[model samples]
Target chain A: MTVNVSVTVNGMRHEISGVEPRLLLSDFLRDTLGLTGTHVGCEHGVCGACTVLMDGHSVRSCLTLAVQANGSEITTVEGLGTPETLNVLQTQFREHHGLQCGFCTPGMLMTGEDLLRKYPLATDEEIREGLSGNLCRCTGYQNIVAAIRSAAALRRENA
Target chain B: MKPARFEYVAPASVDAAVETLLAANGEGKLLAGGQSLLPLLNFRMARPAVLVDLNGIKELSFIELRGESVVIGALTRHREIEHSPLIASRLPVMSAAMRHVAHLAIRNRGTIGGSLSHADPAAELPMMAMFYAARLTVQGPAGRRTIAAKDFFVDALTNCLEPEEIVVEIEFPIPQHDGWVFEEVARRFGDFALASIAVSIRRGQSGIEDARVAAMGVADTPLRLEDVERRLCEIEIDVRMPDRFCEWVRSSVSPNSDLHASGEYRKHLLGELARRALKTALAAKGDRR
Candidate 1:
C-alpha cells in the first residue's frame, strides 16, 4: 500500500504520495530526491554512514522508514555546506584529515556538526564520546577526534 | 533490503491507532522510532500486512516523573531517555544502561516501547525494567491495562501485548535501593551482550534489606533470579557474601550458546559479573544514592 507523507527535506518541503511503506529514508533521499551525498552502509543500523539529522537529532536513515519521517524536518550532508562555502566542521575534517576514504565522511560531519553545536567547547573525550556511534575504518578515530576538537575550538572562538 | 508490501496508516490519535490496529487484527505492526522495526522489515524477519505509524501521535512521546515512578511514553526515543534529567536522577540505571544500546544513531531513533516490545533478550532496557519492576501500560480495543515487568516478557522476541494493543508507556518505580550496578560483556562496543546483569541492593542497619538481580542474554527473556536473591538474604552486605552468591548464581541460569560465546562461558562470566557488580554497587553508594 501507499501513503502520503509531506517531509521537509533540507529545508525544502515536498508533498510525496504513493511512497511504499518499505522505502527507506536513505533510499528516498538518495535515489528518489537525488540527495546522493548521504551514503548507505550496514543497513542493519550498525554503521553510521547513513546518519542524517531528523529534527536536529542524528538518526540512521537506512533503518528509518520514509513513512516514519512524515511531517518531520530532515537535514542531509548536502545541506551542510557546498565546496564554495564550507561549514567549519567540513573545513576541520579536510584540514585535520578527519577522513581518508571519505565514505564515512558525511556521517562524521553530520554527527560532529550536531555534537559541536551542542558542545562548542567540548573536550577531546567528549568529542570522542559524541562521535562514537559513527565509525571510520580508515582514520582510526584519532584524526576524527582532532578534527572535531578543532571545529569546536573554531566555533567557540567565533561565538 | 525492501520490506514486504503492506498497508500504511499514520494515525493522529491513540484511539484511532487502536481502531486501525483492530481492523487489521493481529496482522499489523506499530511503528515507533523505527530503528529496530525497520531493520526487521529490511531483513524480512517481520513482515506485517499493515504498519500503524505512531509518529503522528505526539502525545505518546514524553518522559515525566509521576510520584515515585518515571512514566516514559511508549513513543519516547532512547536518545531522549538517555539525556532526560528526570530519568537520569530517578532511574540512573536506565540512563546509564541506555548508553550501551547499539549506539547514538540507533538510540536517536529507537524508542523505549519499541525495544520493550521487541523484547530482545540481550537488550539493556528490558533487563533494567525487569530489575526495577517497571510497569508496562497498554492501550487496546479492550481499553488500558498495566502489566508488571515479569508478566510482560513472555519469551524472546515476544510479549503479552495483544494484537490490537499498543504499548503507551513504561513506568519504572523509583528503586528503593541505595546501590545499583549495570554491567554487560559484548564482543565489541554496541554489540548485543553475550550475557549481562543488573543488580540493585538496599542496605540497612539490619544488614541487607532488599536485593534484586536481573540477568539478560541468559534465557528466553530477562530473568529476575529470585532464588539467588533469596540465598543472599540474611547474609551480611559485604565482599564475601557476594562471591558466595555468585557461585550459587553460576548453577542457577542455563544460558544458550551462540556465535558470540558458549553457554558454559556465559555461565562462567555470569558468576564473575555477579561478584564484581555487587562489590562495585556497594562502593558506589553514599555519594550517588
Candidate 2:
C-alpha cells in the first residue's frame, strides 16, 4: 500500500506521495528525495550512518518507517551550515580531522548538533556519552571528541 | 534493511488504538518509540499486518508519582525516565537501570512500555521491574487491568499481554528500604549485558527484614529469586554471609549457555555479583539513616 507523508526536511516542506510501506526514512531521503548526503552503512542500526534529526532529535533513519514520519520535521546533514558558511561543528570536525572515510560524518554531525543544543556546557565525559551512539571506527573517537569539544567551546563563546 | 510492507494506523487515543488492534484481528503491532520494534522490522524478526503508531497518543507519555506508587506512562522514553526527578526519588533502581540501556540516541527514542513488551532477557528494566514487583497496567476494549511483574513476563521476547490489549502504564512501589545495588557484565559499553542482577534488601535490628533479588540474561525471562530472598531473610547481614548467599544463588538459578557467556560463567558471575551486590546493598542500608 502507498501512503502519503508530509515531511519537512531541512526547513522545506515536501509533500511526498505514494511512499511505500517498507520505505525506510534513510531510503526515502536518499532515493525518493535524492538527499544522498545521508549514507546507509550497516543498515542494522549499528554504524550510525543513517542517523538524522526527527523533530530535532537524532534517530536511526534506517529503522524508522517513512509512513510513520508523516507531518514530522526532519533535518539531514544538508540542513546544517554549508561549505561557504560552515556551522561551528562542521568547521571543528574539519580542523580536528574527525573524518577519514567520511562514511559516518553525517550521523556524527547531526548527533553533535543535537548534543550541543541540549548541552551547551557539556563536559568532556558528557560529550563522550552524548556521542556514544555515533560510532567513528576510523578516528578511534579521539578526534571526534576533540571536534565536539571545540565546537562546544565556540558555541559557548558565541552564546 | 527495509521492513516488509504493512498497513500503518496513527491512532489518536488509547481507546482508538485498541480498536485498531481489534480491527487488525491481533495482527497489529503497537509502535511506541520504535527503538526495538523498528530494528525488529528492519531485521524481519516481526512482521505484523498493521503497525499502530502510538506516537500520536500523548496520554501514554507521562511520568508522575501518584501517591506511594510511582506511575509511568507506557510511552515514557528511557531518557525522560532517567532524567525525571519523581522517578529519581521513588524508584532510583529504574533510573539506575535506564542509564545502562542501549545508548543515548537509542534511549532518547526507546520507551519503557516498548522495552517491557519486548521482554529481552538481557534488558535491564524487566529485571528492575521484577526486583521491585512493579505492576503493569493494560488497557483494551473491555477495560483496564493491572498485572504483577512476575505474571507479566511470560517468556523470552513475550509478555502475558493479550493481543488486543496495550500496556497503558507501569506502577512501581517506592520501597521502604532504599538500599539498592545493580551489577552487570557487558562485553561492550552499550551492548547487551552478559549477566545482570538487581538486589535490594531491608535490615531489621536482628536480621534481614525484606529482600528482593532478580537476575536477567541467565534465563529465558528475568528470574526473581523468591526462594533465595526467603533464604536471605534467614541470614544476618555481614561480610561473610554474602559468600554463603552466593552459593544459594548459584544453586537456585538455571542459566542457559549462549554466545555472550557460557552457562557456567554466568552461574559463577551470578554468585559473585549477587554476593557483592548484597554486601553493597546491606552496607548502603546501614548508611541510609
Candidate 3:
C-alpha cells in the first residue's frame, strides 16, 4: 500500500517514506514535497504542464509514478531559479512576453531548459517542434518561440 | 488523475522479473517506460493486481548490431534509438519513425518493447515492426520463444503475448532496401496518425528481389499489404505505379471510421498516401544507388 522513495530533487536529497504506490510524481512534488510549481493540466500525458527532468531527461511527471522515480534525480520548475533572480530562460521569456495567464509557464520553462540543453534551436521550425509537446492557450506561441530563440542565441553567444 | 492502488515489485534481473510475474499468475502488469501503461492505469482502463517494475532490470537495455540484424533489448528507450548512430547506420527506418512516436519527453521514456507489447492500433512502432518483419523474443516461466511481428498484434490495444511472458528483445534485420520511406497523415505532428504507410523495395540485377508494404490506423492492427507488394514487384517502376499501387491498397484495407476520419475517407486516402509513400521510397532507393 505504501512505498519508500529516496530521490534527489533540485539538488536536495530527501528520503520520503510511506508513499502510496499510486502517487503520481506530479502530486508528490506538489503535495508531498510542498513544491507546487509542477502543474497538472490534462492528467493524461497530452499537456506537458507536469514536465520535469528525471536524471536529466525531461519526462511527464503526471504520467510518472512517484515510486517509479525512486533512486532517481528530478528537477522541477522550482529548481531553475527563484523570484529574486530569474534564470537565463526566464529572463528571456519575461523580455519577450512568453507568458500571459501563466498557467503553462512552468511547463514551458522546463521544456525550454531541456530543449536548449539538447538541441541547437537554430530555426523557428525547430523551436516550434521542440515545444509542440507543451501547449499555451495564451500568448499565441509566437513570443514563446521568440523567447526560446533569443535564449538559444544568448546561450550560444556566451559559450 | 491517479492510478488505482496496485501491488508493485522492482525486479533486478530477468529471472527475478519472470519469477515475480509468474507468481502473479496473469494478474501482473510489467512497467517498462510506463508512458502508455501509466496513462491507462490513471484512466482506470487497466487495473492489474501487481505492477512488475522492469526499470531496475538494467540488463534488458542495450542496442547491439548482431550478425545480420540489430538486436535491441526490450527496455531500450525510443530516445536512445532516435539518437543512436548505430541505428542511423544500421536500422535507418527506425530512426525515421522515432521522431513521430511522441514528444521528446515521451520518447525519452517510452520503450520500443513496451510500445510493441501495448500494440496501439495507430502506434508507429507496431507499424515499423511489421514493415521490418521484426522478430520478438519473449521470456516466460516455461522458456524463451520468438514471435514474428505480424503474428504478435491481435487487435486494438491487444497482442498475442501471454500474460506471464515478457518481451525481452527485438531483432530487426538490416534492410538492404533499394528504397524505403515511412509516411503518415496525422492532423497534428506527434498525434496518432489517421492512416500511415511504410514501403521498402529490394531490387535484384534483373528485377525486384523483395518488396514490403505496410500500413497502420486503417485496421485492427498494422496491415502488411502483400497484394500491393507483389504487384509493385511485378510492374515496371513508373509514375503510374503509384496509381496502380493505390488500387491495390484501397482494395486491401478494412478501415473503421472513427471520430477522426471516416472509414471511407481512410480507404480513399490509402490509395493516395500509399502511392506517394511508394514513390518517395522508390526515389530514396534510387538516390542511394
* Candidate 3: TM-score, chain B only: 0.94
List DockQ for all candidates: 0.61, 0.55, 0.74
lDDT of 2 by residue, B49-117 (tens): 999999888899998878888888999988788788887777777777776788767877888899999
lDDT of 2 by residue, A18-130 (tens): 88877888999999999999989877778787889988788888878777678899999999988799888899999999999999999999888878877654688888767
* Candidate 3 ranges beyond 4 A from true positions: B203-207, B286-289
Chain B TM-score, all predictions listed: 0.95, 0.95, 0.94
Docking class of 3: medium
| Top candidate by DockQ | 3
- The list of candidate 2 runs beyond 4 A from truth reads A117-129, A152-159, B285-289
The lowest-lDDT stretch of 10 consecutive residues in candidate 3 chain A is A126-135
lDDT of 1 by residue, B187-213 (tens): 766778888888777887866788888
Per-prediction TM-score, chain A only?
0.95, 0.95, 0.98
* Candidate 2 CAPRI level: medium
Q: Estimate, for each residue in A1-159, the C-alpha lDDT of model 3 and write its tens digit.
A: 798999999999989999988899999999999999999999889989999999999999998999989999999988999889999999999999989999898899988999998889999988987888998899889999999999999999999
**DockQ of candidate 1 (2 decimals):** 0.61
Candidate with maximal lDDT: 3
Alpha-carbon lDDT, every model:
0.84, 0.85, 0.88
Tell me which residue pairs clash in candidate 3.
B178-B285, B179-B285, B257-B263
